[model samples]
Target chain A: MSEPILDRPRPVAARRDAALPEPQAQDPDLELVDRWRDGDESAFASLVRRHHGRTFGLLVRMLGSREEAEDALQETFLNLHRHGHRFRREARFGTFVYRVAMNAALNRRRSLGRRRAQLERLASRQAAGDDLPQSPRGPEAGVVQGELRARVQREIQALSPNLRGPLVLYDLEGLPYGEIARVLELPEGTVKSRIHRARRALRERLIDLVSESDDESEGAGQ
Target chain B: MSLRLGHRRFRDQLSDYADGQLSPRLATRFERHLASCADCRKELGELRRMLELLHDLPAAEPGPGSVDALLRRMAETEARPRRWLSAWGAPVAAAAAGLAALLLVQDVSVSIGLPGSAVRPEARSASLVAAEARALPRRPAPPAPSTAAMLGRRAEFAPATPGAPSGASSSGRSALAACIGSRDTRDCIRYHWMLDLAGRDVPAFLEVFESLPEAARPRLAGDLADLARGSGSATAIADHLRASRDPRAATLAARFAAVGRR
Candidate 1:
């Protein structure tokens, strides 16, 4: 079990905009994409600069490691550069870029073998915790927050690709359902179904943490 | 709030309702259900708070100079004389090695080595459908016809389970598309080779099939089943096992691809 969520702790949810415009409606990213396709290297560079942080955020959440996310980020943009000519008007450049980022992440994760990376990260977190100095006062909210983040990441990593892919693209990355469906090659209905299914699964797994948090919140209020 | 009405309809839509993604009518119904069901209210509260917890995980930056580094790498890539060669050098080298390996493709010693090995649980997407395919009870391979074999066979070739749909229904092209669409290059290569051998050369297909470690058979069978399942094809011979599925392989060979028309 982990600490309950009291308020927002997100620092730079740089991936999620307050208002996400639909990909098909008045896409502003396409002009840059078109320019990049026209052999404007700067256009490509600009595109990377614009979306790299967002994609990096996604990769970290999906891959669960900064180093892995960094490598996948490079692979992603490089693939984009080499294959920018293949870009279609069917998707917003952001959507297309995300699809590429996700593909690279999935490929890299497979090469290293599935779940092994996240398991290593979790074990290392425990090892790091053990290495911390013992304190007189009961450990603290930060430790609880760290553990909760790790648990959430582990649970997310534990989900199968089909399920996790849509959920991350939707909830974590803040992608619209249509874009997620496009990215995953699934129908919109299937995407929503999978998202709900994934949420149900996650809620079940973290129910203990949720209960503990609820109890803590109640205790603190009292 | 009543506890006895079994208000799961509202319960099930909690996430959607929380997100305001539900239709107005549905949302109204949910609100009505919520007003009456204390359990639903508790559940929704927990669900919303959990969602907030998920959002509490931090998003991150690519660190300073990451974009520039990627650009520099791309620029360096562009600077190379043989850009295509440099880019594809690994796959090209692997193909050369594979070609070298192909000389020994007919080498029966290598082909028989892994027929009994266990499945490695290869790719992510294959696991879900493979499990389902694995559940179908396997039928024993009947004696093969004199001409067919997995490089090592006792003259028995059965058509998967009884009444397994034959090649007429399963098109290898669709399977190839689905496999490639999966974005697993190695599996794509396997499907490519398997499709080639299955359609054009039965003996070669058998040699390659028999050469596969025992573990790979079910997964391959399962992947093919999964692929077929995607295409809405009913004739998937997914239950073919490593040992007794030899007969199933014959039908699979016939069915792994029906034609090269694609």
Candidate 2:
């Protein structure tokens, strides 16, 4: 994976302004959006550079697969190009981009689910054996931590998209409840309840996974 | 009034409290409840731990070629408009086929008349001529056309005289007088009738426009040459028709263009 320019210890702030330019950015995103609408191709490239990484991260969290996320990311930018004229100046550009990214990721996941059986059949035909490739990090780097991460990922993926979307946007992306509500087209109360419920559900599963991993570690040591 | 703050209630508050999202009153109440509840305290601690774990989830990074591939795809999409044909192609073709079937089934009458020549020679009044020469966009768009609508019911020039009730006839006559006082009654009445017809039925307006005497077309299409300023679907159709350079059609197009309705 390419290095993310916005990655820092203070990711919340970084994510918020991830679309801004690196040095002396003269124009805001709205200005760039206008220029892009007027057929300024470079303005669009500037927008892509500004938002693609953050958009890519959002797709990965929502879709939970790099290959699918990449496809969704492309679709998201293409849609932005096509429909940028519909952007209302009254709204935040970041919010608009987030809505587009979330929609593209969720839609791709929905279609991907329908195509899974067909994909599996194609995969089996190309596979040399049923055994999968090993992780490059190997099993030495804290087996319990690996299992915990894997289990957490599996549980998150298993979450209904409605609940999972709010959780990812609020917890992982640090978007406020109101913003999540707008992006998800839910009431603020619904977003808040979903976040709370999602946290409780995730905590329960993580707690169970931790206990199970502890028991296994103890058994192995004996 | 005081409300119950039981284990269930406290559990719900724990996540909001961790996020510092609770109102001051609710926070104070929850804190007061937490001061005595050990079970609630333990649950809050677990919830905070989970939040921390979630916050620490690694940010996803895109592969180096991701942006390049996206740009390439966008370029290809820009180069190939044919790809978009699939979006509306089937529906449009089906609608076209259905329209063709309808047209084939119906033996419609084709009228050939001079452009803006709807005025009956005997009924040509000075007030109607005066009303027709007024600038474009005199009134807002009429209601949308429906198949069962009485087309051109308002075509009769009802001159509004003093002491008469402000009915359709009065307004129609008043509109005619407004156009006639500014220009020739012949041109004004023709232009006014054409505008009304365009609003009522585009196909009928186009038929008359196409059949108009070439010599009288330009003189009749006053202010209608610039009818591209209207709103909604009517303006869109007007814009396409105005491109035909038919002077009478342009006059009709201007009428639809003046009204900002669908």
Candidate 3:
């Protein structure tokens, strides 16, 4: 069994605002959307720059590849540009755009037939400890953290898109379940169950990894 | 600490507990369970670490020119207009092909060479006229029955006497509308033919029906079915013709009755 890691629970509301910077005091995202609707091209560029990082990040994790995420990013923006006039003022613009990006990313992932292949590749990479993001030389603890990051990513990649999409949106992005329901177009109850299933799947994967390592060390000691 | 929580409930609360999302009452119960359960505690710790690793993964950056390329594509798309040729090109092509077929059927007025090819030249011409009527946008007014019989043609193609509804012109638009509304290829052509044939004189169609041989009865039955299927007046015409003693009329009326029930 793994030992408890002494980690404090962060405030969900604070984390939400930190991850997604609110439309600032003077310059709101809606103002940019209105300008774009009025044919201001520069307003569109500003919107893209403001939202692209998180949108691109979401797509990357959803697609499990950089190239496909890039393609989907273009599609999401193009759709927004074309249909900007139809944007309803009642809902939050950020939620609307995230919904668009999630739909486009999920569609692109399904079209490529890479869901299974991607999971298999991530699993093998996790086994080899090659799933970590590249980093310069650091302390021994950083190496361990990188490996742990790699293992988590592999398990996340292994999850089906339905489970993975909600998990990433909630756990990684720190969006509320209500916001997640808007993004995924799912009921709040469904989103909750999916997140719970996703965490369970990830924990099970970790437990399996731990057991295998324990067996390996015991064999080596004998 | 009084009630021991089951493993199923422990697993369900683990995700919410890690994120501090569980309600305060539920959280208290979960904490009570955690004190006594080492297994649940280890799993909760693992869930926390998993959440941390997910959050720690670096956000991906969009490559340069991503926006510029999409904007350029959008501009290209806006510059193009949606056109009728792009939208209805396939159907227009099909209509043209149908028109060409009607012309070909008209050209081949002679008796076709087939085994037991005993069909009269006039009957063959009548069938071609039927196909042509289906191909045309509007059915032409018919000649008088006396004139048609004198010309050696079927009497059903005769012009209407005064005071009748003039089924040919009256029902032409409705049948054409049906043709447009229906997706079935065979039904569209059949409805078009029936409307054109009876559109001139309803009884004239029965007169023509009575004269056709056994081999042509099945098609006549199907046409009657199509006509009766669409309009109440056509159903009435079929019922009116049902009392006829002629075998062909009986077959056509039976088909009309069968279709009307449906």
Q: Give the chain B TM-score for each candidate.
A: 0.27, 0.28, 0.30
> A2-69 in candidate 2: lDDT tens per residue?
01111111223345346333323343687887766554556676688788998888888887678888
lDDT of 3 by residue, B1-262 (tens): 2234486777688777777766777877777666667567766755665565577787777777555444433332322222322432222222222322332243321212222233332223233233333422331332344223312222232224332212233343354445445534333433443343443434545554444465765775675566546654455445554644445556565666677677
| Candidate 1 CAPRI-style tier | incorrect
lDDT ranking, best first = 3, 1, 2
For model 2, how does the per-residue alpha-carbon lDDT over B128-167 read when each residue is reduced to its tens digit?
Answer: 1122212112223223332112122322223222322111
Span of ten consecutive residues with least summed lDDT in model 2 chain B: B103-112
- Kept native contacts, fraction for each prediction: 0.29, 0.31, 0.41
Point to the candidate with the largest DockQ.
3
lDDT score, candidate 2, position B139:
26
In Å, residue A104's CA in model 1 sits off its true spot by 1.2
By TM-score, is 1 or 3 better? Answer: 1
Candidates in order, interface RMSD in Å: 14.3, 16.3, 15.4
Q: What is the DockQ of each candidate?
A: 0.15, 0.15, 0.19
Best by TM-score: 1
Over A1-222, each residue of candidate 1 has an lDDT whose tens digit, in order, gives: 112113213322233443566665888877887765553445666787788899899898888889989889888876876666667878777878888988998898788854776776667556445633232122253346576577678778767677778878878878777778877767999998898888888777556545434454444333
Candidate numbers sorted by TM-score from highest down: 1, 3, 2
Q: Which stretches of candidate 3 lie over 4 Å from their true place?
A: A1-10, A17-27, A114-151, A208-222, B1-5, B23-25, B64-66, B69-262
